[model samples]
Target: MKILDKLPYFIVAAFAWVAIVSSCANQGMPTGGPRDSIPPVLMSTQPEYKALNFSGEEVQLTFNEFIIPDAISEKLVISPPLESRPSILTKSKTLIIRFNEELKDSSTYSLDFKNSVVDNNERNELEGLRFSFSTGDVHDSLRVAGKIINGFNLEPEEESLVMLHKNLHDSAVYTLLPNYIAKTDKEGNFLISNIAPGEYHLFSINDLNNDLRYNEGAEKIAFADTLIVPDAEFHAEADTLTQGLDSMLIEGHTHFSPEPFFMRNFTENIYEQYVKKAERETKYKSTFVFNETVIDSFGIRPLNAETKDWYILEPNEEFDSLTVWIADTTLAANDTIPVEMSYFQLDSLEQFYLQTDTVELVFTEKKEESRRGRRGRNEDDEEEEGPEPVPQFNWTTNLSSSNFELNNDIVLTAPQPLAGIDTSAMLLYLKQDTLQTPLNFNFTKDTAAWRTYRIAYNWEPETSYTLVIDSAACINIYGITSKALESSFKTRAEDYYGSINLDLNNVPGDVLVQLLENADQEEVIREIKTDEDGTVVFDFLAPDKYKVKVIYDRNGNGKWDPGSYQDKFQPELVSYINEVIKVRSNWEWKHVWDLTPDPTFIKNIRDKELEEQQRKEAEEDARRESEQGTNQRQQQNNMFGPGGGISPGSLRPSGR
Candidate 1:
């Protein structure tokens, strides 16, 4: 309500009017000149120009503008490398390099700055800067170039090591020292220059341990297989040895290592051998035979029990064999009993000998003494039963849902919850047709309480099939039996399929591509390798939604390699394109993928060879100099008496 409050409204109105007038005046008016395009320039060197026989410990290089340091040591190659690594400082406009070791005498040293200097703002690199100087004459100017490839996939392996050895032999570089080494760039290309050429053994290896040596176990190596020298050219191809997959379970019986078991008599031995006859039918079973000594002991036990009307044992006197018999009226497929012998002895020498079926008999023995006082009795004085019998579960499948599609996961839903069953005992099988025998199935338990189970099959299209769930295949908790079940179905036609094409960028040719269906994301539909152009295509895919994945394939192997924590190798980089495509009938879908770069370190072959040659020359020069010094000393000693040995006294007396 004060005059000041009304005055604020009037002031705001006046300011708004003034802003509108100013906006009208500034409309379409030119602001400033064009942006400056001047590149960064070098200002000065700390030691100044052509500083003769510069003996300073450090050199400072200053630029007109701020800059960032690239992989300095890796990108910066020093000919006649110093014993100690030079420290590079980039605190401000000045870049300083401090040397801790003395320089070689009368030698030309060249520092090849390969893309290690870049401007701070736009990261524009200054490539191929050479700093050359000589204490005596001129610098060496030899060069070498080569490509690096992955040992496993036979494709370009970026960031691998390419080394050169002065001495050539299969085991030389692997065991002995290498002269020099360098890392490959992202394109798997390398170049090394400023070298004094010499006979060298060129080798490329993925030195996983960074030991600068070709470790046969830890590194994959490729060599020219001969001595190489200046102006010589050669190509080396690296490939990995294929590893074998572990054995798969074929039938119900697994291979058994033999154990010793004694038999009561010849009849018992024969019975024991016959009991395992079914084991021979298994695909992986081997022939088994009982030792002669084991057979002899089987004849020693007394066969004292008499044959009853319900159970009988018939001996074949001529063949040393016995036939177990049960009265036809009481005998059944599931009925079984343990044969008792008159004599009590260790039965630990039984040997299996036979070829019949693939079924194994596993017996669980119950000692009478363990249950002696625990027997129960009824109120009427009759002994009560030990325990209630467990219920059995048997499965039956509808043929219509049995045939599996590549895109669709087949599910078997139980009609009711199973009771008192050992679900683990159940076996599933598939058959090409009703007339053909069944093939073993690898099934996994899905839900115990629901009695649900699932099996994933790498099924092909248009295949007729039958599924079988056998009776007596599963034993209940109380050892009750379940009846076998089976079904049959034919797959749909193959015309309902499609194909997919993937175009990948920045992806290695060795990258692995996998197709997965939407229904079972964890299940793989198919796996393919990317071509050199980074393109992967999957044909004959069933109609469904699918996802694509690309793995870096670090070893260039056509598969993903798992990382080991102990080795300190991180998991191979993986990228998912995340494009969900619905492949319809007779349709084709194309996808493009730009893979992310992996963190990798590789050696350059050309640089390594060049460095090796330079190192050898340096060593040879040092050796020659040492020999000359030794000879000069000996000559001086001879000129004077050995004891006088060019003493300062001799030189002073001559001057006086």
Candidate 2:
């Protein structure tokens, strides 16, 4: 009752309590800032600042801000590492490091804080902060500086480790930490400070295996032939070391090696007829058998059955042997099929070699009879039942060459010798630009079974010329009319010519050079190989600017191949210098290319182009959607506006 009488005082007390609670909630709230400003900066260390004869088990460091430890283990590195890792303690911005093992009696130790210490707020790293302590009276402060380059391209290889070893043995790097070590930056520059003056072997390693050691099979190592140290000034130049391919490893162990040669024999005189019919009819069965130990896989090259021809077949992949299956009807009854087989194998020097062989097979009469029985009877039996007429032999004109330049001499070759043909019945005409001209012919025998007649005529440049053989030009042994054939080709002008010269310098002693033009930019101009002088010349090229490239054919295989990663084989490093030489009329452009070192600029350009293409595609898609939306809106307006039978003024609001 007495408290109720003092209501005004009680109300005042309650209001004051509410205000205090609201003020406390608004003040001192967690705003995600550090508990204190000035993140962990090192002030001073123990042992009285560079005091000599220091043999302390515990070292204390004072900082200006509260410290949190996360990357202490990875960022901290102790030179001549201790048997065990040290312990770090944080007590109110004071970091204390306690050694867990005994140190050498009179040795110097350096602690590198490699981006380890960071502020708690934004995780700002402290760079290049190191502390040095010595048990001896003197400190080793001598330094060395240099750059690390890739031996292949003479370009700086970033993040490469440059190490110095007191001993040059293989196990030195594996067992002991480098006496002095530094990593190359993006510019390939490195500096090792506080190195003890001594004779040391210096080398740079890619360290792909992360073992901190050199493995020729897994790592690229650049070593100086001589020793380097703090007292002696030296520079280390690196070379790209290429590992050879091992022949012991086989690729795709499933198939046998393909044979280079195969043969199909025929008894009947159906060479031309069978070739024409076989091209349309895909019936035939052929099997290939080869040495499984010598090759990996094989394929058959296309052949001309009418005229005994030779063709080259390339292998698909690496294998000991390969078997190919072909249909039997591809050959005539008396035709012989010639084949070339390609094989791949590793040589003793750990290099790959492509081996080729030639083989042949004869088509016999028995095989032809078996094929006829396998082929079912056709509907043509009704027409053949009426009368058995004498088979008519037909003669056809086949130009031995299908494609030719206008500068080349025109030659008409016949399949058979013209002995019984009437000379007056033959008519040959050559025409160009509506101008008909008669060509004088001179007959010459090529071989015992074939003959050719040469037609002389001066071809005009940049003009399409056609040769026509009228019907009944020559009669065959069976007295049939010859089929008329026509061929046409446009002549190249004198202005369409150019040349290029390659000058290679500092080439390896046993390397072969191959020059290749970008096919997408130009037609198949030509391919040339370099001589011992490392020079290749390409003449009579069509007038065009082309992308030129070269390959250091290390194995003399006459081809370029990408090396394998598992075998520790670096690819055949190709280079495109990006120098577009314009080949003009009557111009001999000489390009001095030194392919001794590989180039990576082309790869960079290709990657950039790929990114640009992707970006353009995205932009095009956005534009296409915008256009589609515009078209849809226009169609909707046309359907509802004036002429579309829905007047704008007559339309009313939906709510109304």
Candidate 3:
């Protein structure tokens, strides 16, 4: 009873404590006064910055405000990089850097702390805090700056390591660490300061292992064609990759040659080619997946079975996967099958060697009762006992509607590969005003697909046509016959379609112009090669919005080839015309596409769209990760607590 009576006193005490805390918080809270726009100011340094002949392992930098030291390990750039990273600790408002390894004597050392430290109150970053000292009397003070981007998409590559190597051999990137290094920002912009004046080989790599050296076949790289010499003269150069940095400014010396050099990064096509896996997903389908593209010279054969045309070989467009459909039912019925797979394997010195391995293909399906029962139910909701339904012979066609498109073929697709297709049982007739007349048409199976057949005929616009197929017209490999099908559909009127006449400006003739259904390039609607004058006409496009991409077709293969670095070949250059052609009925849209390669133009057009798309995907990914309890993201709200992180919405330093 006495404790219950003291509840009022406790409540009063809590209220008093909250008032006192709120009074303390009010002093630091924003109150419409001039916002704290300035970053933490440097007060002094231990051993003083730029002290010569100093033999010390510890350096201290005191700031005007209490600063966080958490991001030092990641954002610090110590050139000539320390073999081991330095440790950073804070005492009151001063940060101390302790070297873990011995520094090279008689050499200039630069400690570039790029926006790692932030003020305690506002969390404002101290941007570009650079300190330099030399064991001897000399200090290097030159730099180089550039932007890195993906060669294919022109997308800016963030966090890419830009390296400067004095040893200009091609093997330097393979065996040695960079003399000086800087990481690209979100806009792919990088600035390496306090570099010694000398000619250097500049290269950029994604640095997958953070070993500072570019591991061929494991990393994407970009390099300068010519040696770059750092200078101290301020050469005016505009940042071309992005406009995001206009919001913030930075104090920098323009003592760099080729300011803002555009580097197009590319990943080599040489990766270890191993048998990724061998699996039999279906009774008749056995698939072999390779880690890299199958170079058309690979071979596979059954280890203990007949090798004479025992299976049908089907490779995907990328040639990375091969589907082996069993021709012999006896072989497919077996529970497991062994096959010898031979493919090219890469060596450490970039030489190819043939590797053979035995792989077992296994598949077994467990049958279970259907969770989804019959559509109709009994009053008691009991399982209805009835005769089992017969297996259906499944087939589909492109004629989904009565109004068929003139540009489309009446494609017939089976659920499984076909054993035989009898075109003699199929009939097509053209419907006139009242009478119908039989027409000659070619019904042939597609070379690439075993189960797909197309009925090709001269379809007259605004004319009705009738197609009839007998019950046994097509038979699958499983001995199931197709059901009888009949349909009367009318070809769309000529006015219902649209036409596109494209003039490929600045492009050579015979270039392939592909009509893409979407920006992702998952599906290509139509493809046409330009004429000798770089002109092409697509006369029968349906009224729909479409995107256009041009394939250079350098090898005259008529298909876009993903290039090989070992062969010194680049993927057929594809240029996307950055506009959606909204075709309306009875319209002829003529457009002149500029095929000239302008990465800056593409980057500018794609920046907002890419950011929006990535943001949506990142949000969805974050939500899914959070729901799955696997997200490890940690936020540092250190104003009233302790955190070393400077996250988004925190005060970041100016400039990319």
Top candidate, metric lDDT: 3
Q: Total clashes, candidate 2?
A: 38
Cα error of candidate 2 at position 207, Å: 3.5
lDDT against the true structure, each candidate? 0.53, 0.54, 0.76
Scored against the true structure, residue 135 in model 2 reaches a CA lDDT of: 78
Question: Model 3, 1-656: lDDT tens per residue?
Answer: 46677677666666665665566452564677777878999999987777877689988999888887878878888888778889989999889999998888777788878788888777888887888887777777777888988776557899899999999777888899888888888889888877777889988889999899988777898877677988877655555555576554433445445666877778776566777678898878988888889766678787888758778777887788888888777877778888887888878887888888888878776665555443655645554565565564857888854678887888888877777878888888975535545679988877766578899998888888888888878887777788899888888888988888887677664577888774554268888876355667877887877777776777787776554434544445656766677777899989887776443444443334457789999999999989655423232134334454332323322322
Best by TM-score: 3
Query: RMSD to native for every prediction?
Result: 29.6, 20.1, 14.5
C-alpha TM-scores of all predictions: 0.41, 0.40, 0.71
Count of residue pairs whose backbone atoms collide, per candidate: 26, 38, 0
- Model 2 TM-score relative to the real fold: 0.40
Residue 508 local lDDT, model 2? 53
Q: Model 3 residue 43 lDDT?
A: 93
| Residue-level lDDT for 626 in candidate 3 | 90
* Positional deviation of residue 426's Cα in model 3 after best superposition, in angstroms: 3.2
Q: Which pairs clash in the backbone of model 3?
A: none
lDDT of 2: 0.54
